[model samples]
Target: MGRIVGIDLGTSTSEIACIVDGTPKLLPNSQGKLVTPSVVHIGEDGGVLVGEAAAEYLFTRPDCTFMEVKRLTGGGEVLKAHGKEYRPEEIQALLLGYLVRCAEESLKEKIERAVITVPAYFTDLQRRATAKAGELAGLAVERILNEPTAAALDYGLANLKECKNVLVYDLGGGTLDVTVLELFEGVIDVKASCGNNHLGGKDFDEIIMGRLAEPSDSADPSADERALMRLKKAAEDCKIALSTREEYQVSLPFLLTGAEGKPLSVEKTVRREDFEDWVAEKVNSTREPMMSALADAALTPGDLQVVLLVGGSTRIPCVKKLVEETLGTVPRSLVDPDLTVARGAAIQAGLIEGSINNEDLVLTDVCPYTLGTAPLQHGIFGRRVFFDPIIPRNTTIPAEKSKIYHPAVDYQTEVTIDVYQGESSDPANNERLGELNLSGIPPAKVGKESVEVSFSYDMNGILQVKASVLSTGRQVSAEISTTGIKAKAPLDLSRWEEAEGARKFRPLIRKAEKLMAAGGDPGGDVELLVRRVKEALLLKNTKEAGDLRDQLLGMLEALEQLLQLQDDRTLGIDRP
Candidate 1:
């Protein structure tokens, strides 16, 4: 058996880490960098390119290349670029496949049994899509942890060893997640959570791109489009550069293209202050949400002992300054802010594999929002439809919750069901997660009929829904449809049996074999990690060293079978 690897499948950058002995450690890429850009390029023939190579092609191959993919996680239209359309899930799997391969190569072992992280605000469809991406990549995704919760775990294991209340402020590349965690004895309890799925670093990039766009002129639309893209890329570079230096220079060498399709190169130097000012609006949006999450958790800024920041966007001086100004205390820099979530996820994997003693650690998470369904309640204007919440916000996961509904009219023989996911009372305002219809009931006075609606959400955030007529055992069913993260719309199995996309993604069967050959596939940077794990365990602290030894052996063995085929159906692994 081998160790279980933890992955932060982030929107902008992805990272993997593992626990050695009793401590968490980051697994670096071949470049010796902890974070790998979650970007990928699909060649004309479908051979995939990932990481730095893929990032390099972003500007050069704008058409065929896909980035900022986490934007389209659920069922939505595929994005078009470089004259090609891409389903978000497909592109995501490609990225996951690359990371899985990198993990195997780095560790020189068979890698299996991974704990992957997702945004707290991801809808059911979105979560399912993420899971499918892991399946396609060939890793047995043991659990899908929330990103903010993972950050809290990192804080719990490393800094907040003593019982204390903490808040995790995670503003990443594509979403914002705020979680309140309390450390009691050894448990890391997430009291409350909230976030904006459409906000974060990519929004900052778009803001700069908007500001850099050349003023529109009716006569030359093509010129403006070319100039804008060139300037936008240049502005983004300057933004990233300024974070590390007092000031940075930007060169938009091809601000505008000539009649022969040649580009005009322009240059500019940007100061940190100026760039921050340009992005102030994007940065300010975090304030309201931070305050809202505080209100929801019934805490004020003064109540927090430690405010942990997680994500690459937090590296910006302005972003850090704003948080400090609001909380009146600088956040602790104990964890490599960028790798904290991945480290936390790996720590969780260790616990799940029974390698680490969880007697001291319990992670209690909340449902970020409400789950409901749309049904006609009245016939004011020919059957008025509205949302009825089943499970309210902030409920714990791996939880079973149910709500009962009764007939609205006399002699009703049929009932319409429209399942929804969101906090709004209006069905239109919330996303239609799924729906079904129930029939074949004894025609009785509508007020005499009854139905039981139940929903069970597993720890991984996958959902199971059930609706049964009490009088008649009559029911219908539907599961959150997930063909891949790249699916633009749910492919109806009956109508779309061909499944061109489904057959295209190769099952990770063979890759699992190579992964198993490696003793412990710890993901990328495994070679250095093996050395680090050994050094950490040899520490003079007897108790800590013993804990690490047990954890390491457990992870090593589990990692071995994670690549092998398991016969258990309930665990959700596929047969060879």
Candidate 2:
């Protein structure tokens, strides 16, 4: 019954907005700025500080300040500052609560719910962590909207009747996302999205830090943590200046102490040309996501009517130029890049709250990752495992897909369907979301026992998997969720790099993929060994991993021999 605004909970900055008089407007903070920094601090007295006040402690009290909390959203890392431990979600809550207070003061209404925006490529865990942060702030989260999708909403609201395909290129403070969307006849459908969370303005800041450090002979200015934080601040300022001017001079008084024991004042005059050169690689990296999005949308540069730019990082001149060169089209800035997501979120909140006309505002999104289950089968060596994709990446959200698999062994009475999300053909290379185990299956022949696994991915990115035995009608289900609303503790990834072996075993994987691509296989007995090795690695069994590795390698050599034989046969040449 109260006001529900939209919140763009970003990595480097955060903002809130609401629809007033059928127009979405941003709510400014106490500092009179529409955008608020996402930085958090723990005061000496253990008081929680946020936004501008928190930024004041960045250099002097680097130990008490926390930046880039967004990167820890779904992970299990705690910030120990000022003799206090704070979870990433807790720090975010402080910032969100500040925004809520700002909104309530500006609107003179008690805000209860909000629609928050995150990166399109965020996992279900990450999305839920955002909602948990909102809950910690005492606000009911209306929904978790993707950042690019939110930006598209802001773009679509203006051109409701236009039939055009638009690409959303969002390069923000802490992440970069490219989304392809088509708007026609009051509908906005997201075709594809790709991004890297570790890439953005923050990385550019680091490059600036390195550039500024090149001249320092007194000491490695970045050697001390405090000095590094100070340099980081300087880097940010230098970056903002280079965006508009050909050159900018930065002088930090007493940045470090020289070998002579006197204070070292660092000064550097950076040319925009040089700045762009350092950042050119970072900017170029975004090109991959743009192409990936284009391919996923099944469109070309000529197919797009407009290229929309969103987020503060998009303001950089180099970023703009790179996008134009790659997309072969200039960016269309109908909305402010920095404020677009929050404004779009406000529009979403308004639509949900019935404060604006939204009957024509139909928006459809997609699952950013492939969803499937691990099923076992018989192979030449032994039992083989495969990761069959059920709901593929970029498939429309609020979508459900199912695939049927039969038991591998005769007289099997129980079955387990381990769910995973990724693009890898090998299930072992994917992320395990959850699993469903069903019992009481009718004892039958290997091919006769049938089981169906269904994956339902909603717009919020949560996945619900249901499994059933066809013969006995036995069923089981599980939903992968976080400490959603009531905001409890979170879950930890079993072993983050257990799949590091996947990278080391790339050659073998490629060989298997090539063999499968050739069609009509089964000449080699390697699938079973590969499956065993993957299972062992996934279980973090080092001994088993080593043993399986040996087995897989030997079999791989045989498979390579078999491949050579196939090549000889295809050429109609007699073997030596």
Candidate 3:
């Protein structure tokens, strides 16, 4: 039997790890890097290249090279390369196969079994697609772990004696997940999880890309794949650079040819303040999920003992500040934010392989979405289809819940159980997993025919539904399969609103914006302060915003004094 390894198959990068000497350690790739770029390129000779080797071709061979395919998993989209069609999972499989080969080489042993991690908000179809990718890579998947839960495992193993309410804020390359868990005596119990799968660092990069192409004289820089790829690469670099430095110079020479046949370039100095402003709305979008997760866990900001930052995006200064202000606590990155999830998955692999004692560590996770069946009901207007939930969202896994329902029509003999997953009251707004048709019900009045429906959700997040006809004892069950189902659009968060107090800062915001536009401060301090105040307002951090408002007012007064002093000196009124 080969060893079991843990893999974090991410949108921007992928990593492989395993347990060594009772400790989880990350395995390096062929390039001697801990993380592998989630990129693949197919050569004209039908050869496949992955990781760093494939990344080099992203600009030159844009048609055959694929990146960020993790975002397309479980969707009904097909990618084309050199006249060959490839599914998202197939591309992911190529990356997975490369990771496994790297692991085998690093460990000097075969690896045939594995544990994989996915975002907590990933739908059933996405999870199934992830597992399918693992299978396609020729490994027996031991478990499909949630990214936040896996991060908690890594934290818990090191501090087995400490008991604390921990929140894991995971903002990766392509997804955001907020999970609240309790750590007690080596047991990690996840209370609730919420997130936006479409929001992440990639979105921030796109914001930068727009800014980079703003000065181009070309009609459309995006019309050329090579030029677009160049812009994307540069945008990503600029985003990473501004994380540490206050400003970064983005200079891409000859990005594209203009309509006049002259080459146009992108020359811009991106300030961190401007970058934060550009991404403020998207970054602020994470606040709702954090509050939702904390509320679902029945926890207050004061109750949380620790906030663990996970994923690469958490490194952003604005993101870190958001976590601190929203949770009323300083966030901690005990482990490398980029590598913690993989380490946790490695620990889980250790547990499943009998290397780490099961009694020493135990993990329990929750279903991130609600599971239910659509049933007919009488409404004010007429008969309507309503979502009747059996297992609510955030319910601990390996759970079973049953609800008894009656047929809607008189003398009904059959019923179709349409299962859906979401928080909406209407089934049409939710995702349809699978359905079961239960017939052979004895003839009876609508209210008398009772059909018992039960839902079973396992630790792996797979759902199984069973429906039984009470009178005839006829039953039908199925393990919900998401195969052939198109993934629904991203969740709608347009209705989210900031706290009521955010309104009170409008005057201050307007004043700050005016001052920023005047631009007399040489250090750009006024601009930075203005951006922070706006972010605080967007995040609904009244206290932080108020403090920043005071600071801005003071700065404005000082600037006014300096300007008056300069005028007096120029007019010879204060000549000494």
TM-score of each: 0.78, 0.79, 0.82
How much lDDT does candidate 3 score? 0.87
Candidate 2 — which pairs collide? Answer: none
For TM-score, candidate 2 versus 3, the one ahead is: 3
Instruction: Give lDDT tens digits, candidate 1, residues 378-461.
Output: 656777878888877777887778777776676565566677888777899998777655654444555566877787778888
What is the Å distance of residue 137 in model 2 from its true position? 1.6
Give candidate 1 misplaced runs (Cα > 4 Å): 79-86, 218-230, 244-247, 258-265, 330-333, 379-383, 482-576
Cα-based lDDT for every prediction: 0.71, 0.82, 0.87
lDDT of 2 by residue, 480-527 (tens): 655322211221223423575656766765676576576524632344
Deviation in angstroms for 251 in model 2? 2.2
Off by over 4 Å in 2: 214-223, 258-265, 377-384, 410-414, 439-445, 482-576
| Model 3: lDDT of residue 76 | 89
